[model samples]
Target chain A: MFRETTVNTALVAILVAVPLVAQAAGEPFIITLATKVAIFAMAGVGLNIALGYGGLVSFGHAAFFGIGGYAAGILASHAQSYTPLMTWPFAIGGTQQMLIIWPVALAASGIAALVIGALSLRTSGVYFIMITLAFAQMVFYFAVSWPAYGGEDGLPIYVRDKFPGLNTLDPLQFFAVAFACFLLAVLVSVVLSRSRFGLALQGARQNVERVRAVGIDPYRLRLVAFVISGMITGLAGALYADLNRFVSPSMLSWQTSGEIMVFVILGGVGRHFGPLAGAALFILLEHELGSVSEYWQFLLGLLLLLVVLFAHGGLIGVLTRRPHRD
Target chain B: MTDPVLEIRKLTKRFGALTVSDGIDFDLRPGEIHALIGPNGAGKSTLIKQICGELHPDAGAILFSGRDLAGEGSVARARRGLARTFQVSSVAPEFTALQNVVLAVQGASGATFRFLRPALGDAALTGPARAFMERVGLSGRENVPASILSHGERRRLELAMALAMEPRVFLLDEPMAGLGPEGSQEMTAILSDLRHEAPILLVEHDMDAVFTLADRISVLVYGRIIATGTVDEIRANAEVQSAYLGDDA
Candidate 1:
């Protein structure tokens, strides 16, 4: 608890304080960067639910992320053009409201997860990983070929989408929105890690047979976790697309999936604030070292190798200086 | 005898050419310990798996509470008052002993889907879980992670988890495999007392514990039951003596 508390406090302070201080100094670019950190951290938190707690290494999480991005992108696009999303399906219209977009993103991602998880959960280990990756690629290719939403050219949002009472175009206000979401996501993860479902999911990760012997269906539990995990990542994707005012086919790509996994591994899988710590370190390295050299990804890869080989538990493990629990 | 709680009839399993279980018939009545004893590779673990639904029998019927268990998953079997402990000490390594028992308690209590509220603070789960740990002789070490528990303590923890299920029957495999003489004695005493609560279909190689605790002994040799009788009958039988009891008999 001590190690967890320390890491959590540091994460909350850095995530909140850094943005506020940067805003006070009138560094709007830093605020935007901070918002990216929060959004990506939220995405890592989503993966942690499946990978960290449920022990499900779903390599296709970008499908959910892309679906979420597309949910926001298509909705905002339709709203901008004053076109209805569907004429046959009850004349569904689009809106720039964050509240509406979030639920739609969650539903879209959750359903995709349900379908994918139902198939993938039947297989495990490398097979599960490959299946998830294959599904993500299928979505990526579909997004690439679907020309209506710009396909490979990507879709652009004319303006930053609206929240109920905030001017989303303002970087600081948007940071607040993303930061609030980041907090909520972390809160959800924390609560879940200590809840009955969390215990069962974690139990399934440790030993599926034990969970089954105890009368809990591991398949059903993993599927629920997978859906919730996708919904969270989907929400993060929506916020990310809104932040950039664009949604690209690459959002659904395998690289995005890898990056989300990197956030979880780099942060320390299963640690309370592992994703935040990992996301912060990753973004900082990308911004700092990335500008210093053209081949910063090589250094990033080397750092990740070092973390896997020696640190084992990622950034949070290094911070805690002790063996961390799953 | 009246109808047994668990009855297995003609249970058979095979891997292509090799038959691991061959027309096995077994039963356990309430308030009795039915010990299944045999040498290594005699399919004791396979038999347990079939009863617990971890492995499907090629041809057989497992009747629990007089209902056929065909097409039912392990979870369904478990929910219907069937509890099993692994030979390999299979409690969750990441959880504390208390947390492990609480999970078993929650599994039986039907609140497994509840999220948002902190399970760490739930009195409904923790209270009964603590009692189970106490029952299994793990009172003070409840907070220790299962990974750090001693081998003997892990077996006890597994027992605590089984008790938390409030099971109608217990399928215990190798419960005394690694216990020291004192630990074995203590486990024997616990099982002797536990039989009054629910019947146990125990599989073990510890003859001392079995001879002391068993109400009836079934000797399995080469995937086939060679003898089923009282402890005195099994000890006196020449076939059981030659096959499994060996020269010591």
Candidate 2:
């Protein structure tokens, strides 16, 4: 049996090594796929903070993901068209720099999460899940109907956003950026899970009454966790849109939320590298199984059912052979 | 003889057809164990809830340290040094015993917002938490997860958490409920020593524990205090005997 840190280190090594090997083999497509895994894993890491650590079970994280995507999409589009995003309100303009766009994306998603979490956290269990789902649906519909940023048709970026000291247009260069973000998100998740706030949040998850009895307001703790979670997922969304050079209402759809959740569940909820493992497995399955049959998702669904029924703690849990701390 | 640290004036709560709390006036003085004893369905639990701000009293003024607690919630009340243990031993089962106490210590310190420093590594939280665990006779079981602990140990863990808060009043609900005879004796010993740290408002079904530790006893029957007196006075009261103590005394 290996320590969890050993397992986590190996998982990170695999994620890094796979992309580097692909770049060496001149398989840029594989590098792109690995980059997608990094971005999606980053989103899963975000959702895990709220859903796993906080026990929030939010099902509307796609709203933050889409907000991040649109922040990049709208900003890059505005920059390309040589138009200001707003003429009034101090003449705000868009930028194509990833450095600038990342902050906008994070702030937008964080604010959205704050508003949604404030209202949604008032309810718990199934109601919390449903309310979050409903909020994400509202965002999806708004993106679909709004005419400003291509509405239902979606918006496209002609060029990928720029990051200083690197050529983001190169597949390996872009993977570096996404991989760095993923590592940072993982770092934040790990640090937060061990902190004082983490203890209270996890305590609130296990027993809200006990947490309140100890003089900590569980609501505020959860709200802060939710916001941080959304911000991380939002950053992933920005990188995701940049990867494909496009943003769409589909990014805000409930399917996206479910997919992000699958990554966490498949890897191991609350496990430090759970999302990364889950996302990697998901992408591998999608790629390998899709090439074999059109009904690849059917196989994925079966695997998910097996994981839920038998594995208990997902892939990491099965590998570690330890029961997850509830 | 001194001022009551907690004073409840005419606290009343009605669940539509039935009144759970019927204008209950209660108080806990400094440095004394005030035991609230009652039969099942006598609203002892309801009174505890109202005092701890879990349930809203229909009408009443709860004064803690001479300030009215009109609309404060459970968290606010707890922060103001009103510590309580549940009858069912509520704890984070996933957390280690030390972590549970550390959480209480952190809550008391009002620094739960610290996001980077690892909680277990910090001597400040773990130091007091470890001492509280030792105080409650859970010294060597610091690293044991709350779920696997024996029922009696969970009870002690809850006590350690309350103690870590450095509370002014201890609202202990049936601290001896599920313990065996030996476990109950140990708990009684621990609780007897605890009163020196802070006054206690004990709700218990175990008559032996109540008689042994209570400085004063208040017998509640059907949401009303039937008797409030010394052990001998309560034993001699005919109304209390028929209403509660009866053959059990």
Candidate 3:
């Protein structure tokens, strides 16, 4: 069997090569699809931190993702219309810069995570999952009902947000930006997995009693992980909004949460590059199978069942034939 | 003699109509293996839980050193140098033996928020972690995952984790519960030497090991201490013998 590191390197190389090849071939649609994979993979990476490492099976990560999307959409829209987001409390204005947008998105999602995680983490196992789903539903309904930013119709950015040097309008350039964020998310996952906090978080997941016995509050550890996870996913959501130039209430839906989780489970929960593999596979299947049949999701469901039943570690597990290790 | 490291004053806990711990007073000295021996379902586990802040006693003050531990949670108690090993080995099964010790070391160091630096490679954590593993006679098996380690090895790993904390007191709940004769003897020897590092509140069923290792024995029955004395005194006490030791004595 190939070493996991070798497999991980190959995965990263493939992801990078696919986009470049598409760009070179003048297949802008393929580049866009690849960019979507990267953004979705980044979101999966965020969920993996809390779900895989911290054992917090959050079912409402869509709340953070949508919050991030809205952050970008609201900001860019405000900037375009030359309207301040808020006139009071020191006058917070919206910006079209990716740099500013990313932070705002991250902060928004992070705060939402802190609130949701604080309440959701008070319950464990099934209850935790349910509460998270409930919170995401709340966010989804709020997005749908609110008229400020298109509500159920969703909000759109007239133009893509600006990065420091890149032409955000170009598909290939946007792919590069999305891919960088994806790689950074992967790096953060790797660093976190090997760090002290990662150890405690993993330990808490494995045995909450033991973690407490070791003098670390598992709740606090989980809460912190949830916040970081939210921020990463939120950043991805911001990028995703830029890629589509739109933010919708659907992003906050429970289906989005389930899809993000599917990426993690399909790729390999806890594996550093699991999300990337899962996201790529998901996007590839959607593109290929969508052309073959309208019921592509049914085939996807069958594949997910197979992965869960046979490959407990997901795609990475199948490739490596080993369980995930810190 | 030297002002008990842990002093429990009239600790009482009642679950509905059942009193699991009834005004129990206990003390663990600074350098003695104070063994609390009792029969099955005699609330030995409940008393241990109360001391470790897992189960809050309805009444009584648990003083660690000189400060009262009333509202402090188990995590806080553990952080204050009160380490414990579970009856069933509770080390993180997915973690390597070395990683388990490293976690304990990290917990002891009070810097769990440190991210970016790899924990396994850090000299500060691994160095002491390695020493603890070595001290527990698991030097060669440091990299072995805890899940696959032999039952005895898992016990040692738990001990290594506890030792990594450099605790003030070791709340060892049945450390020899599942061990074979040889494993028990090995654990007995390790624990006999462990008292010098910190005092121990041993809750065990193995009488032979208890008699061999305990500096003082406290016989608990029906949620109360019936006898608290040296090994010889405990062996001679008729109430303790009839209540718990019985045919074993």
Candidate 4:
């Protein structure tokens, strides 16, 4: 317990401290990168709930991520344009509040997850992966064709959304928000993995028949896990849009789903701080290695191969001496 | 007579040209181990599956606690107090024996949807789970992962998990499948004690264990119940001898 905590705490501390040190040295760009790492890690954390614990290899989670991005983008646009989202249904208007947009993003993505999960979970293995990827593609195409929001060109937020007390435009302040969301996602993941629902989810992942024989409906458990996972990823999407000040169909693309999967795999699937570590290593590699060569992704592929071939549990597993009990 | 805890009537199943379960009728009265003995292709597993709602019978009625279980899924049947152990030892391989039993206890407790609270720390679940593990002779191996346990231990863990469900009927399929002499003897003793708690629909190959623990013995051949009677009665029957018991009789 102590060793695991020490490792996880060190990772969190370094993630939090490195950006602070960079910001102190007037290198705000490093802080921005840190914010990206935090946001993307949150996204990985979301996917881990379903993929890691529930054993759902959702190749289309970019749907939830992109939906969240759009939620942030569209809402902030309406708030900027001084246009009401809907005049009917009691005159609903858009707000630039981060608190409001986060919940809305979560709801939108969660509903999307419910619909997709309801259908996709009916199948398993390669078929399940394909169905999820297909659903994500459908969303990607819809986003591209919806010209009202710039279509393939994508929507942009004129200004970052406002937090209650912080200047979200300030890179440091925004990093704090992203970090808090990261921590919240981590806490939720940890709490969930120890809960009855989480136990059932993990059990279903291990053996669906055994879970069913125990009188717990594996489908319902998985669906709920998927929905929750989508909501967390969706919240991260909202943060990502604010960070980039853009929401594009690219965000909903299959590539985005693969990147999120990379984060989980690179750190350690189902490990507590796996996403955070994975995201940090990923961003560092992309930044440091991209500056060195255009073939940085090739190096990444090599690293991932080594990890998969040697480190069955990913980076954390390689780093930690003992295997983590799920 | 009072209604049996579990009753099957005219159960029939056909897989293309073969009839796996052919118009079978059976019942389990409360607190009696009714053993079903049959040869390899005689459809014992198929019948167990049909009873456990894993397979749908082409024609039949399965009444549990006098309620007809038609179109009910395995999970629904399990929730309705019909628990089962597999022919092969099956438990959550990654989980500890305690965690596996705790999951079962949580299911039986009807609070599986409760999130936020740590199930590992829940005395309500872990307490009963520990008790069930102890009852199955797995007290010291509570923290051991099910995968690392020996085959007999895994079988015991299966029983522990089934016990945690607080089942009213146990449809155990070959609970003694891979046991050695000592393990089989221990399993026979455990099952003999289990029958008094809830009637078991035991399907077994071990003649010694079956003859020792079975409150009533039923011989199945080609999906048909050829005979149902006491141990002496089944032993005395010439047809049972020639068809099944053979030189052992």
Candidate 5:
């Protein structure tokens, strides 16, 4: 079921890993860069779930991304502050635990997506896009106003956080953890896209009235997918906050949402590895552009506009020129 | 003998100043080829849309197998052993011929949600899809994408998609819309064979093909079924003669 297309795998691998290895040297940078790739890929994978296979153009994933970051940052800050977020029947202090934080981030994002998708699904065409963006903005402003986690100033993770055996301070171990999560997310996407619901989702996108005629409620299926997409994207956000050891209102901004989308479309819309390739290219461009000149953003913008106008299929589409089944 | 598979009574539709369906009534029996023919704007497509639940008639009751279908949507109607192929053949352009058929099969095979099985290239779908394509003369082109298919080939692919549902009744809208004489001949032969197993409501502008294959002809004029009779009776009807046949003459 899972077939990787034959390309210059070694070349792509070296291109991705070597620079990372060099910058990483002995410690932090390697781990941080690997984490960046893994986390961003996870976010891109989330976008692919809705946009690629499902054909939903959600322009507001930063809400989920920021939500994930807040989930980790808030919990860690609570633990650091020596104050329990809440207590059950008795009293319990907050703990910065991945086991707990992951589920919270997932559920929070899922629940938010459920509400957003439920309402957003009502409109089609340009209206649906605007509504989704509006909902994300609403949450973004709410995060900005809330004083919790240092408000606009942001909260710092005093500790690198804890995993079962991996040292939080060691870069490569942390990268490995993020990489495992990225792989799992990819596997989940592969499974879900081929799943029965996934087929209905794709069908619904291609022909909504047709699928409804077949006796399945397309709204319900799409909403669930949207929620799952948000949950996964939110998880990426949590990892991102941990990666930077900082969480702020900037994470929840519209620009962040726009950037994630740019990454997805730049790779190849709906292609499995499209997101990974897109994220890698984006990071490289950012680095190269930044080093080349201060106004590197102008070059990045020029490059992206060219890609969109000339290359309809993005990077993978440019490379393969043929459709490959994920 | 029993209730007809589909029953339409007093179906009516109007658009602003014009009436698209003027109080139409019809019945479709199992294993019958009911030909609905008329010149353009006769509302044949409109009536088909109403029956398939894509349009809501202004006044009417459509009962399929004795169950009311007034409130049902197109997809719901499709699930009730009713299927339709649009005049334009609304298909995913990116999908291959086999994948297109499998998508139809996916809806009917109790597996539309199995996103994990890699159904596109798998034999689970490919085997039956191949057989269906062979049935429709598309066996040789399974690997090709639907967009690149010849017009006749795409028409054949559309039939394969509709038949993949194993529908009780099919609402085919101009299945031979753009075929050449040879292509029309092939389509006519295919329809002749199809009428044996599946009841078909064929809306065709091709008079020769229509007169040859239709078991019963329902002649429409300006949103009205002016006449319904066997081919011999229809050929003799003065109104059908002046309105349609005479024009062709």
Candidate 6:
């Protein structure tokens, strides 16, 4: 039945979307939405690792995403500059190269995640959320004040970052690439969740005291999951920077962080494809609502409140499984 | 005895002027059924907590296998083969009985971090877990979540979890607290069988079950051991007759 819920949701999405995809085959708007789904899905997948699997309620993952994006953006800019690659210590040059950027993005976000996770995990429940938000704000304000790399104005790439032979400027090709990465992320998540460590992690979330009583440390298991979560989200940030050809402090804002969490909740917390479905619905809602009114955010908030108070389980609840009562 | 599995010397615990476990000394021998009986709030649960490293004694020495165990955490205590079942069942209600037991077995099997491989297929651990469940006559209910099981089944599942750890000593807290007549019978029978494996420290309210099963009885009252001996010694003791066991005696 647990497996059935996952399969059912996946089936419904495929069954429902074939016709729409056919209609929007060559349309630019369709391509944009597809990319949005990919991007948001990647970010949601990252949040799922911590929130869904590890039972951590972090509200500042946008900071990790934004850090990764900044790493990619800054490095690409440095590689093209006339100034030496780096001044102090060993000379370090930036790269427009995807190879170098991916690792940097991952490392930057991973380290940021590590610091934030270590501090936040020290406290439980509401305090963890507040501390993560505070740390993300610190990063956001730093981005705003720093005069380098366009500061609050943001940094823009004259040319999109390169990935070997692929001409990433081709919209379809880029979207396909993002989609492929998203699929890989999902596959990894499935494998990890079913793994033994995954069981222990889930067990810790369900009954931490019992887990400890049987000789498994919940904190250590959660720390590893958090790092992996950050790494995956950071990878998404790099892709996002390339897609927009820009990096801004706004990407790291607390609101952006909340949006990622909202996407997870919409997908259904603790669900496999819940995040993916949630991301699609969230972006679609925003796109459709934006056309109706400039003040669509107010309407969106109202709708979300209704959904939280009523639906609770998000899109996954309506489309797939009931809440786990046990 | 020189090789007693667990030795507690002058253990003390306080909750703001109320000394719950006051300077108590206890020892558990190998493969013995030791029963602790008392009214509510007599520090029975507190004693289990101190042994399992949940609550450290304000001042005492907890010697496991003749090794001084102070400052070791719960997991460490468990790895040293000291395990306990919560007074209120603390099992994963969402997981099947077999799955719950396997988690405990998996925990004791050392590293469970073999990612990218299905852990359910690990015959080494799950097989043993299944066997333990079968022993408790839960073979038919292996696939059902613990939440849906009867009160007795949940208690049995709790025992299976602690058993899967392969501990030398088990600290069972009220294994039959909420069971019906049938549940108490089933749980007591299971407890009887469990005594064959390792030394058990049972905290229970059922006087009939306790007197029937306990090889040695220890009555705890007001954070101190009121008496400790065979059933006859407890029944005959003057103070203990008034303090406890009067109705049954």
lDDT minimum window of 10 residues, candidate 5 chain B: B107-116
Worst 10 residues of 2 chain A by lDDT: A317-326
Better of 1 and 6 by DockQ: 1
Clash totals in order = 0, 0, 0, 0, 19, 1
Instruction: Identify the runs in model 1 with alpha carbons over 4 angstroms from their true place.
Output: none
What is candidate 5's DockQ?
Answer: 0.45
Off by over 4 Å in 6: A1-26, A82-85, A324-326
- Give one digit per residue, the lDDT tens place, for model 5 in B1-249: 756888899899999989988989898888889999998889999999899887899998999888899887776677777878779866656677887787777766755655567776568777877888998898789888778998889888888888777788888999989899999999999988887657899999888998898989999899999999998899889999899887554
Top candidate when judged by DockQ against the true structure:
2
What are the per-residue Cα lDDT tens digits for candidate 2 across B1-249? Answer: 689999999888899989888888888999999999989999999999988999989998899988999889999999999999998999999999998999999999999999999999999999889899999999899988999999999999999999999899999999999899999999999999999989999999999999999999998888888889999899899999998888667
For A32-84, candidate 6 gives per-residue lDDT tens digits of: 56676787788888999899888899888989999989998898888777455
Candidate 1 Cα RMSD (Å)? 1.4
User: Candidate 1 overall Cα lDDT vs. reference?
Assistant: 0.92
Q: Residue by residue across B29-112, what tens digits does model 1's lDDT show?
A: 988999999999999999999888889999989998799999998899899888888999998997899989999999999778
Each predicted complex: what DockQ? 0.86, 0.92, 0.88, 0.88, 0.45, 0.70
DockQ of 2: 0.92
Evaluated on chain B only, candidate 6 has a TM-score of: 0.96
lDDT of each: 0.92, 0.94, 0.93, 0.92, 0.81, 0.83
TM-score of each: 0.98, 0.99, 0.98, 0.98, 0.93, 0.95
Highest lDDT among the candidates is held by which one?
2
lDDT of 1 by residue, A1-326 (tens): 35668778978898888878998998999999999999999999999999999999989999999999999999999999999999894899988989999999999999999999999999999999999999999999999999999999999999989998899999999999999998899899989888999999999999888999999999999999999999999999999999999999999999999999999999898876788888888899999998999789898899899999999678888878788665
Q: Could you give me the TM-score of model 3 versus the true structure?
A: 0.98
Where does the lowest 10-residue lDDT sum fall in candidate 1 chain B? B189-198
Please identify model 3 stretches exceeding 4 Å from their true place: none
Please report how far candidate 2 places residue A209 from its true position, in Å. Answer: 0.1
- Kindly list the per-residue Cα lDDT of model 5 for residues A139-203, writing each as its tens digit: 88898888866877888988867888788667666676777787788788878877667766777
Q: Chain B TM-score for each model? A: 0.98, 0.98, 0.98, 0.98, 0.96, 0.96
What's the CA RMSD of model 6 in angstroms?
2.4
> How close is candidate 5 at the interface, in terms of C-alpha RMSD after superposing the true interface residues?
2.7
